[model samples]
Target: MLLCPYNILHKAERRKLLHAIGRCLFSSWDSPVYFSDVVLADIFTSFAQVVGDVWLSLCMLLPGHSILKPHTGVGSRWILPTVMSLPYLIRLRQCVIEYNHQGNTHRRPLYNALKYASAFPAIYLSAAQGMVVGEGGAAATWFGGSHIFRLWLLAGMVNSLYSFWWDVTNDWGLDLLRPRSEAKKSESLRSPPRRLVLPGLHSATPHILQGSSSIDVHDPEGISRSVVELSVRKRCHALGLRHSLHFPLLVYPFVIFLNLVLRLTWSMKLFSVVNVNSHAGIANFCLKMAELFRRWMWVFIRVEWEMIKKSRESHTKHRADDGIDEYELIPSATIERTPN
Candidate 1:
């Protein structure tokens, strides 16, 4: 009878030991190995998609100057945005395929896809600017010296700046306005009150008491509370304002300057100054820019890897210092008696 019990216990312990070993191996494979694969895939995919989109967009925008030529000029302007959007759609499709294949709960791929997609508009805008202004055009007369174009450009600049500012404000602003599920309303409630008071002659008054019998109706918590409320509301608005201004303020001016320089260099016939050598130079410049972008992507990946490594190292050290071993996780006597 004692032998029977001992046999059963041994079998049970053996099964448990096997399970633990399987778990450890699975964890080891899942974390670092799979993580690296996902990261590499994401970095390459993002870089390729962005570059491809930019190239495609440029091709569409400057069809006469570049490879892409639409047979119809009726819907030509729409071609750039449409063609440039393909890479993003392709990336999404790939993510879905990977997700189905991997069958893992980790959403790294999906997250990466969404993040890259979110930046697509901005990327498109930047690339479009490069195509339109960086390369001189027949349409140069419209944008180069036209008052209407300048006004439109100024409007775009102001809008982008305001959008960006509004985005920043909203992002860092009112926690109370965000959805309860995503926003930590409890944390906001628990935050300590700001002691900094507004400086003014009538800081305490809501409406300054300019005349006799005027009541001061200032709520001390009003500004702070308003800030918390404004956080979520202004996020998109601020970002839009800021991003919109970038093209007008920086990109347009830079393009104009480059055009002027090129014109001066080529005796004011910038478009007529084109030659085989010039074409080659332009190609080389584009290739170099692509290379630079690729290198930047690699740098980003390296930084991510380093951060992950440090995080893992710290976690491992913490576990070691705490004397938390996998073997010790189960309180079985058989595990205790096993050799370390």
Candidate 2:
């Protein structure tokens, strides 16, 4: 068992070396071993589906753009897309099942299955041209009675997208989107920090590492932390026991999600957005501005919280002259005075 761990550490070290070489060659060295296969599969599955949907949506726009009248016997026009969506949906089901089978604690099986189920209708709508308003459009067949039903259908699609995003990101672990090597490369590119030793008499010296941001100093062994850390880390690195995870591209998806939510919220206002001719650009802009204002408020609150934390820590951590902690001091019932 010990040898097994030792061997695993060796492999991790090899990955580290490969990561360094990849940086020199400017390639994705830190990508998961199966990353290329995953990328290709996603291209076929996700990218192809997106391309097909955009094609159909654009085809509908042909009437508005005056390109040509859309095809009669719409069934023939949509047959391929509808057929294609079956495999996409099947793949999604299989993926969720397989993920559950893997015994992933971080991802819930039933929740993922439900999310996938939720996404199916939206996928079907996009693929089958269900949103088009005329001549057996999905909206007409399902909710032609009133505009309220139509808005409800649109809300369902939005909810599907929202649920789908949450499932995908959380299930797959956003770190899988980018290679660990890339994250390390960015980490390595930062300037070396300068340590400032603050004057203090204690078990550990209170100091700061001078850099772009102030960092807490936890070591006081009178040795370079990096060297000691590397040695200990090398010994502790167990290949199969410890897995590496990193995702630098998560921010992009979050930004996209924020915009999507903003757009959806904009659509919800005044029910005017659901009308055929009305536009929601003004609402979208206003919501985006409101989101920015909220973010600014959050930043201010965080800064104040940091200040409060520091004040508390400073007053709480002192050691008494009697080698007792400041908190250990108790109220004495009687007082004694020294006479000179």
The whole-model lDDT of each prediction reads 0.38, 0.39
Evaluated at residue 288, the lDDT of candidate 1 is 44
Model 2 ranges with Cα > 4 A deviation: 1-70, 77-87, 96-110, 125-132, 136-161, 164-340
The alpha-carbon deviation from the true structure for residue 42 of candidate 2, after best TM-score superposition, in angstroms, is: 4.4
lDDT of 1 by residue, 209-232 (tens): 211222223555654554453463
- Model 2, 54-118: lDDT tens digits are 55456667654423333435564455345444434543544454454544455444554565454
RMSD per model, one decimal: 23.2, 17.6
- In candidate 2 the C-alpha lDDT for residue 215 amounts to 28
How well does model 1 score by local distance difference test? 0.38
Give per-residue lDDT, candidate 2, residue 45.
37
Sequence-dependent TM-score of model 1:
0.28
Clashes of each: 28, 1
